[model samples]
Target chain A: MSGSVLYDAPGPRARARNLVLSVVGGLLIVGLVALVAYRLYDKGQFDGAMWDIFNYAGIRENILDGLAATLKVFAMAAALSLVMAVVLCMGRLSDHKPVRWLATGFIELFRSVPLLITIFALWVGIVDAILPVEVNIEPMWALVFGLAIYNSCVQAEVLRAGINAVPTGQREAAYAIGMRKTQVTASILMPQAVRSMMPTIISQLVVTLKDTSLGYIILYPELLQTARLIASNTQVNGDYPYVPTVIVIGTLYIVLCLALSGLANWIERRGRRAKTGIAPTEAKVPEQTGALP
Target chain B: MNVLLDNLDLFREGFVGTVSLTAGSAALAVVLGLIIAGFRVSPVPPLRLFGTVWVTLLRNTPLTLLFLVAFFVVPQVLFPGIDSYLLAVVALGMYTSSYIAEALRSGINTVPLGQAEAARSIGMTFTQTLRIVVLPQATRTALPPLSSFLIALTKNSAIAGAFNNVDLFNIQKVLSNEGYNILVIFIWITIGYLIVTFSISALFRTLERRLEVAR
Candidate 1:
């Protein structure tokens, strides 16, 4: 991770300076930890009972349910958004100006709005107002559609960037062989684009997974929402277990995202090492576009 | 449309809150991000480790979870009397700083190796070389992505609305409960957000053009 070129190898005095800086940095981190620990101890946050709330069968089940709910939304949204991205990407690159304009508008609008607002608006509009009372609309669908719409827009842009990264010569060669524009894009450029940008696409999938937490706002029983319920409803010795609950759930999210990111990196490495007649264009790293894109 | 006019005060309040949240968080993120970027490129091993750890943990975690921690956890364990607004700003700031740092680090990497070597060849120390040469060029390359990260920060402030800050997203919840039409409430919210985000992008584009160097 070191951009070592920025500096020469440390001489004796420079080594001494680095050692001093290291000590100071380490001390700062340790001091912050000690302060937080002292505060927690003063507040009885270290109490065993505070953390024992996880021992309850109902609470464990609720946590599991929340995990399942979050994954359910993520899986559905992931699949739906990918499909929608392709369609939107097609329209975005369409020969028709109107289609391209419509695609661009949809992307910019959704990407600009907050995911929390999109899900909340969708929950209110779709389930509360638009749907007939006879047809029960689950909050889950609202969260899923909201995520799908916002993420699909981002993914479409990523796809467009990827497609643009493809060399012009590949397209011209396709054209010289009498391929139509659609055929050239689909059969030639799109595959290379998708391959070149696989890392970014997966990275965005990680973003989608993280964003499913916004389902909490719409009252969907995702991990964050469930953590709130468990923390608030089940007090431990007259205090809410916010600290323990958050630590546990937040660790779970970190693990899941790290795993997904590891996959993205692995694919990126393998892609780089692959042999091919036409080399994959090195696509620029896509913007980390959400909450958390 | 009339509904927005009727509750114009609420929209105005929300607008102010959103802008304030974005501004506060952006300031914090820039400061923290620059520090982390410094750590990332520094010769110190522990400092680099700290930067990497901070980015990985924060960037991987969802913003909503950070808000949850900021709102629910901070009051209980870290700070006793922090208000929701401050908590929201801190959460958004901390979350966005990771991305900003990553953007800045990549920008640093984009600086040509020969430039650093050339600086060293001329008898410049690491600090002098980095200060006068590397950082300036890196910041230029990093401008576009850094601006995008700031835009993401603006969008992220919407999560604050869910946590009791009176921003545009929260305004929808308030207006809808008042029996206003969802479509109309959303329309206004959308317009407010579009204005903020579009303005940010346009401002950045102008800065990019102004900052353009012959290199």
Candidate 2:
């Protein structure tokens, strides 16, 4: 703590100021939202027939198809990224000077470079130079490879921190038990490190999911890009539907992320339950009673 | 050498865009991040949930996507005819704020609980404890990661190139496309990024040193 708080809570004057600020802020938000709606409305996005287009058979099919592609690409990129992360992590942690330096350099270099540049460069390099022919190896792959390369560096650091957080005594105990270095790393250290850093790991995965949208820049047609195409296609009265479509699309992203967050919370709770055996409510009850003191 | 000499003006312009965007958005983001971090660790369940959701959505989403979403999709959806520059700021600010929230939250977490408890024992309100007591310490600990995120933010602004904006990478792209000096232009852009990153890292190192000396 640096210093003591000068005020208790906001007094009336401060509260009034806060209220005014909030009202202004609220208006700004609502005004922006209204402007978006008005643009869409003016463009006839809200036309009677257009509103029902979500029920259109072809549009529904297109959304599903798009969703499938989004999931497939995200899954592949995420898996490959994890494998690369482990490799990079191991390399960074290695005792060998050359390996460590190479890993560190690669991590820092890729991590510093923009993901879009990586993907664009990789796409051009592979198609124009690396590959024998004009093969399209899923621009989505390029995006993922780029995402994975950068994120693996981040994951490697996270894992390294987790590994370092483990007590030296644990490693010594493992060695004393005649465990090989590999056994100590794989069975003991890695597991504990991963468990401790599970939240960070999960958070990174969320990043992976969001990064899937970057595929749009290369015309890979991930969710946001597809939504843009849908919104802009003149068939939907150009401007108005673009806003609603984007809102719907953004909301979809919010929904997916929130679902993932809920899952993380569930896992955290289950883990705590497994450890304590007593329910959280029951655990809190004792604390509440002790609060009397 | 001729190419570098000829394209110097464009390089300078691009560098300006990158720096301004990074600095402006970063300042707003740090403030927003502090607020979100407060919400994240707040006793109010709803406030905490709001903060968590914010971090999750913004952090998980790709920065480029958010950039596009903010620039194109967000304004198009929310306020049909909002200014592109404002949209850019809003999107970048929100996206950057999420990462700041994460960095700050971790920083806050690292602050010993006793610090806050001691503040409370001294009769400080929750906001008081957080502002006067908690945040200053968190700020120091969070500096390295914050600087790292700023570097990341600067690099990510390269996506502004895709938007056809006159940012550094886009400027380089334009110069290369027009002059056909591809390698030099890209090398220039790369150097520009490295300079930004290295300078920030150096600044952080200096700050860390000063902090140590003060201690």
Fraction of the true interface contacts (Cα pairs closer than 8 Å across chains) found in each model: 0.74, 0.26
lDDT of 1 by residue, A178-218 (tens): 99988998899888878877888888898999999988887
Q: Which regions of candidate 2 deviate over 4 angstroms?
A: A1-48, A126-138, A237-240, A272-293, B1-6, B35-62, B73-86, B102-134, B171-188, B211-215
Among incorrect, acceptable, medium and high, the docking class of model 1 is medium
TM-score of each: 0.94, 0.78
At residue B18, give the lDDT of candidate 2: 79
Tens digits of lDDT, candidate 2, B1-215: 57677878888888887777777777888889888888777544455666787786776565665676667655544556776555555667788898788778777777787888788778787788888888888888888777767776777677776776667767755764574444455556777777777777777778977765354
Tens-place lDDT digits, model 2, residues A196-292: 6666666666666776777777788777777767756635533335545655677777777666656655655665656632222111000000000
lDDT of 1 by residue, B164-192 (tens): 89999889899988889887888799888
- The whole-model C-alpha lDDT of candidate 1 against the native structure comes to 0.85
TM-score top scorer: 1
How high is the TM-score of chain B in model 2? Answer: 0.91
